[model samples]
Every structure is written in structure tokens, then in C-alpha cells.
Target: MGDLYSELLVKRERTAKDSLVKYGLIVLTALAVFAGLFITPLLLIAAIILGIACYFVIPKTDVEYEYLFINGDFDIDMVMAKTKRKRVKSFKLSDADLAAPLNSHRMDYYNGNQKMKVLDFSSGNPEHKRYGVITRLDGDTCKIILEPDEKLAQAMKNSAPSKVFLD
Candidate 1:
């Protein structure tokens, strides 16, 4: 059979809290600039710097997660601002100790364990369904949270029937 290859890109959605924070920063910057204009020219320069800082910090960033499933291996990439992209993680299907829906009871046993390393590759939107992957690393089962497409899930199940859990 030919190798199975699939990719999915997930974009992050802004939260209400993020909007509130951005607006709060803008209001504070405006207040600072107004006060600085009335106080001193030096103060105005300081306010300009503050405004620039806020501009870089408060803007809602666009982040996209790229998931690639090739054969039995899964790779995750993080794309920031539509320009920067970096590989986040990669794992083989056979290495997974447990793979299940994020809300499934199959993850209950490992959820509370503090020793396991947890990596979340999801889009950060709670509305999107995610999957949980537990793989053995350094004698500990590391938890990986990801959003996989249907074809990727099928490919995983076909490669490792005993480990992949879709329900």
C-alpha cells in the first residue's frame, strides 16, 4: 500500500479575556500620552515609548498549528503571524501508550499524574475537539494534546490498532 500522508492547519481564536486586556492596554496608553503632553516634553517621549511597547505586546497574535500525519508518524508545527514556522513535536503511532478523545474516561488514570510531561498542540479554542496522546518517555508517560483530522486518526488506527482510540 502507498504511504498515508495528511495535514491539517488549525488557527487560534481570540478569547473575551484577550479582547478585554487589549482594550485595557490601549486605554492606559491613551491616558499616559494625554498626561505626558500636558506635563513635559520628556514625559511625552516616555509615553511614546510606552505606547510602542503596548503596540507590540497587546495586539492579538495569529497562531496556526500544522498537523502532519505521514505513515505512522505524526508531526506538529507551530506557525506564528503567517511567517514563522517551527516544528513542535513528533511521535510514532506505535509509541503511544494511550490515544483517546480529550474528554474520554480512558485518560482519567493519567490526568492527575504530575510527573508526566504534558504538551498541548491544540488551537487553544475550547470549541474544537481535541485528542489526547500518552507516550512513554524516560520511563514516564508523557501526555500530548492535539487536534487530528479524520484521515490521520484512521491512519493511526490502521498502524497501531491496540493503541489508537477514537471514542
Candidate 2:
């Protein structure tokens, strides 16, 4: 569990840095465009407008974790900690008899008691791809971040099982 937490922290930091870089580039590009229109003041004015537009168009920052645990029963939680604001969603496993399959794609599980749902992390899902929950010997845990892909997102939307569990 400690290792997993550490890994998640590292990944979160890296993501923050990456987002900073991406936004920085957008701002820089906008400025460059404005500067290039030095001769035509109207073009510079247009560039400024475009820059402001781009800044607003950028996606909002979201740093969250989708975690899964398997004990005598399964537990799932989503942790979002940013700017000292914390949000959490937790649920328990519904199908005690069925073991979650091992795959490199996102999987959805439901909590029978709470009727809530959780999604396992996968490299192929942009939303849930950043963190992977791995179980180790002696009940230890590890969390890993993987590059983002679209396959998992498509699968989650298109291939997710209609009947999750027959309880």
C-alpha cells in the first residue's frame, strides 16, 4: 500500500509538470503569433484574441486516482486531491464468486451493497490509464502510471459487459 501511494504521488507530480508544459506551449505559441504581426497592428490584435481564446479552450486540470483492492471482499475508491481539495468515491465488490480478469484494459466492477461502480486502471484509457493497482506478495501494493491510449476508452464505452453480475 505504501509503495502504491508513493507511485501515485510520483505520477501525479509528473502529470502536473506535463500539464504546465502543455499550457505553457499554448500561451507561447499565441504570443509568438501576436509578435509576428508587428507590421499589421490589426493582425496582432487578432492574435491576442486568439491567444485568449486558446487559454480558455484548454481543458481543465484533473488529478485523480482510480484504485482497486481485493481482500476477503473487493474495495474500490477514486481519490482526487488537488489544491487541497479532496474527493473520494468508494464501493464494494458485487460478485464475490467471480474473479476480476487480468487484462491490459480498463474493467468495470460494481458494488452490490452500495450499487456503486468502479473502473480499474488501464494504459489504454485516458480517464483511468494513469494509475494501475498491483497486488504483491505479503499483501503489499504497487501503483504504476502508463502512457495514455484510446483503445481502453473505446472498450469501456463499446465493449463493457451489459450484465456485470447476476447477484
Candidate 3:
């Protein structure tokens, strides 16, 4: 059979909390600049530096996550705003101990466990087709949540029918 391949691109969404934090930073920076005008020239310089720093830090990230599924192997990568891609995780379908919907009872144990490394690439909303993949690393279980396409899900199920669960 030919090699099966699929890719899923997930973009990060900004939430109400994120918007609040961003605006809070902006307001704080404006206040600093306003107050610095009366304090000293050095204070004004410091405010400008702080404003520049906030410009880079406060805004929501434009990072995109790419999920690559080739045959039985899976890889996750981060495509940054600078057009640079970095590998985030790599594993084979056979390596997964369990795969289930994020809201399923099968993930109860791993959900509350702090030792599980959670990698989330979902849309941050409940309606998405969110799934969790549980794997073992260094004797600890890790859970990764991602919104995968239907083709990718089917490919995973075909590759490891016993390990990957959709219901």
C-alpha cells in the first residue's frame, strides 16, 4: 500500500482574558508615559523602553501549529510568526497507550494527573473535534490534545485500531 499522509493546521485564537490582558498592558504603558513627562527626562526614556518591551510581550501570538501524519508516525510542529518552523513532538501511532475524545471517561485518570505533560493545539472551544492521545515517557504518562481532521483520525484508527478511539 502507498504511504498515507495528512496535515492539520491550527491557529491560536484570542480569548476575552487575552484581550483584557493586552489592553491592560497598553493602558499601563500609556499611564507611565503620561506620568514620566512631568517626573524627569530619564523617566520618559524608561517609559519608552517599557512601551517597546510591552509591544513585543503583550500582543497575542500569531503562532500556528502543524500536525503531520505520515503512515503510522505523527509529528507536531510550531510555525512561528517569523516563518520559522520548530518540531514540538514526534511519535508513532503504535506508541499511544490510549486515544479518546477529550470529554470521554477514558481520560479521567490522566486528566487530573499533574505528571501528564499536556500539549494543547485545540481551538480552545468545546465544540471542536478535540481528541486526546496518551503516551508514556520516562515512566510517566503524557496527554496531548489536538483538533485533527477526519481523514487524519481515520488514518490513525486504521493504523492502530486498538489504541486510537474516537467514541
Candidate 4:
């Protein structure tokens, strides 16, 4: 049989908290610029520093996650500002203890465990349904949150029958 390959791209919705932080930084940068103009030369230097930092940081505020499931291996790539792309994480389906809808009871056990590190790669919108994969990462058990389409979910289920849930 051909190897299973499924891909899903999920755009992370910006939370109000993220918006606040991003906007706050912008406002602070503006204030620094204004202070620099009227006050001291040092303030202008500070403003320049802030401006440069903002140039690099602002684009990072918008993010997207791409999930690739190929032959039992799952990979998540982070896309920043629709330009930069970096691999976030990758794991084998066999490593998962269980895969279920984020809201499903099957996830409760992992969710309650403080030691279970959570790696969220899903869309931030509450209205969207996300999935969680309980797997080991760096030898510690972690819950990988993602938004996988039906095809990707099915491929994952097929790879690990005992571990994946359709939901």
C-alpha cells in the first residue's frame, strides 16, 4: 500500500491577550519616539531600539500552523506572518497513548496531569474543534494540540488503531 500522507494548515486566531500585547508594544514604541523628539537624545536612541525590535517582533504576532502526517509520522510547522516557516515538532503515531477531540473525556486524564506539558498548535478560536495527541516528548509525556481535518485524523487512526479516536 502507498504511504499515508495528509496535510492540514490551521491559521492561529489571535487572542485578545495577544492583541493587547502587540498593540501595547506599538503604543510604547510610538510614545518612545515622541519622547525622543522633544526630550533627550537618549530617548531618541531608545526609540530607535524599540523601532527595530518592533520591526522584527510585529510580524511574529500573526501565526499559522501546518500539520503533516506522512507514513505514521506527524510534523507541525509554524508559519509566521505568512512568510517564515519553521518546524515546531514531529513525532511518530506509535508514540501516542491516545488521540481524541480536545473536548472529549479521553483527554481529561492528560489535561489534569500537571506534568503533561501542553503544546498547542491549533487555531485559537474556541468555536473550532481541535484534537489532542498524548505522546512522549523529550522523555516527558506531552499533549500536542492540533487541528486536523477528517482525512488527516483518519490517517492517524489507521496508523495507530488503539491510540486514535475518530472524534
Candidate 5:
């Protein structure tokens, strides 16, 4: 039996394009200050305020993991390891299941029993095809990874209902 934790790879979801507005405001503000036009302090203050506001306004683009049960339906849980105080939420997933496929990776799954297995989608060898989470995605490719927290893994194992597809 392999160590469940070691067998999985988790990629945190993030967006490069989303930061454009945030960075743009900061850069524009800096440029204004350097120009030394009238009311530089006000411009600087406005920029700072805009930056602070943007911090909260910007949507959180954190990575999430998608787990599909044997029946084909799946669920998503936010990866909480990166946060100082972690929070976890499990929600039934539908069409938006795998938001990003290109960044999909392998993970580990335990069926409440002691036995552990690795979910490797990247294995070129088709004979050993293993089960794992595949982000049901559309539009853009979103990176997906396994949750690193042990508690989370245990929770997922426990909460996952048999026969996930209700219909």
C-alpha cells in the first residue's frame, strides 16, 4: 500500500489575466506620482485607496479540487491548505464540474477502507488507467490539484456518498 498523501498532486487554481486591473491601477498611480503634476499626494492616496479596494473586490481565484464518484456525477471542495485558517466546503457539481481540463492532475482516493490508491491521469500507459478527479471544465483551462490537508482528505472520504449520480 502506498502512502495516500504522497501519491496525489494538487495544483492551486489561479488566474493571470484577472490581476491586470489591480496591477494596472498601481502602475498608473506610480506613473502619476513620478510625473510630479499638481496634487501628487491626492493622486497617490487615490491610487492607494483603489489598490486597497481592488484587493477585496477582486474575485478569489483559488484552486479547487473536483472528485467524481463511480456514478459519474462529481463534487468540488476548495483546497484550504494555503490559507492560515482553513475552511472547507463541499458542493454538488454539475456542468461546471471540470472548469479546467488542461491543468488537470492526479490525486489519491480512499474508499473509507485502509487501502489507498493514486489517481494518475497522466500515465501514458492506458492499461493501468486509475480513477481520479478530472475538472469538468469549459472556456478557459483552470488548474486543479488535490487538497493537501489530511483532515480534508478524511472528510472527503467520509462525506462522499456512494452512487454520486442521483439520477
Candidate 6:
């Protein structure tokens, strides 16, 4: 049989929070530079450092989540400004205590659990199709939410037949 592999990339829209952060950093960088110019030359070096740091940090404000399912292993990565990619999380589908559609009742337990840590890698919009997987991380139950296409969904089901639910 062919290897079960699939990939899905979900771009996250720029939220008001992201815009505020981006602009706030810019404003701070500008203020530092101006303060250095008008007050003290010593502050100029700090301002230059701040400006350079902001240059590298700004693009990370925009991000997309990529889901990769190969065989039974599932991984979610963060893609920053279409440039940098970082592995955010990884787990075997078979290890998931439960996997189901976002709105499915099968997820209710993990969703309602007070101790479960919820990690959202989805678009944060309910209109988009997403799935919820409950697994363990560092001895704590963690609920991961991500968008996955048909191929990945099928692969998930194939890996963990009893635990995965699409309907």
C-alpha cells in the first residue's frame, strides 16, 4: 500500500490584536529613535538595536498553520510570513485518545475538561472545517484544534479507526 501522506496549510487572518502588536512595535521603535536623537547620543545604540530586532520580529506577527499527516504521525507547523517554518506540535494519531470533527459530540469531554490544555492551530473561525484531537503532552491532556482537508482526515481515520470520527 502507498504511504498515507497529506498536507494542509491554513492561513490565519490578521486579527486586530496582530495589527495592534505590529503597529505598537513600529511606534515604539520610532519613539526610541526620536528620543535618542533629541536627548542623548548614548540612546542611539539602543535605538538601533531595537530597530534591528523589530525588523526580524515583525514578520512573525503574520502566520499560517500547516498540518502534515504521514503514515500515522501528525505534525502541525507554524509558517511565519511565508518564510520561516517551525514545528509547533507533533503526535501519532494512534496515540490520540479521541479524534473527531470540531462540532462532534465526541470532543465534548475534552472541551469541557477543566484540566485539559487547549491549543488552537485553526483559523479561529467556525465557518472553516476543523478537527479536534485529544492527546497527552508532558503528562497533561492537551486538545489540539487544526484544519485538515479530506486526505488528511482519511489518513487519520485509517490510522486510528475506532478513535477517529468524521460524522
lDDT of each: 0.80, 0.36, 0.81, 0.87, 0.37, 0.86
What is the per-residue lDDT of model 6 for residues 1-167, given as tens digits with 9 covering 90 to 100? 68888898998878898898888878887888898999988888878887887788888788999988898898899999898999999998888899898788887767778877989998888898889889998889889988888888888888889999988
Candidates sorted by lDDT, best first = 4, 6, 3, 1, 5, 2
lDDT assessment of candidate 4: 0.87
Question: How well is each residue in 85-140 modelled by candidate 1, as lDDT tens digits?
Answer: 88978888788888988788998998888888998788776667788899976676
Candidate 4 lDDT, 1-167, residue by residue in tens: 68999998999888787788788888988898888888876787887888888788877789999998998999899999999999989999897888999899888877788867899898877678788889899999888888888899889888888999975
List runs of model 6 lying over 4 Å from the truth.
none
lDDT per residue, candidate 5, 63-166, as tens digits?
33434332223334334334422223222323323222222231212233243322322322233322333332434322233332343334334334331111
lDDT of 2 by residue, 78-112 (tens): 33334333324232223222222333333233222
Best-performing candidate as measured by lDDT: 4
Judged by lDDT against the true structure, how good is candidate 3? 0.81
In TM-score terms, candidate 4 sits at 0.93
Ranking by TM-score: 4, 6, 3, 1, 5, 2
lDDT of 6: 0.86
Q: In candidate 3, residue 157 scores what lDDT?
A: 87
Q: Distance from true position, residue 131, model 5, in Å?
A: 10
Name the 10 consecutive residues with the lowest summed lDDT in model 4.
38-47
Best of the two (1, 5) by lDDT: 1
| The candidate that achieves the highest TM-score relative to the unseen native structure | 4
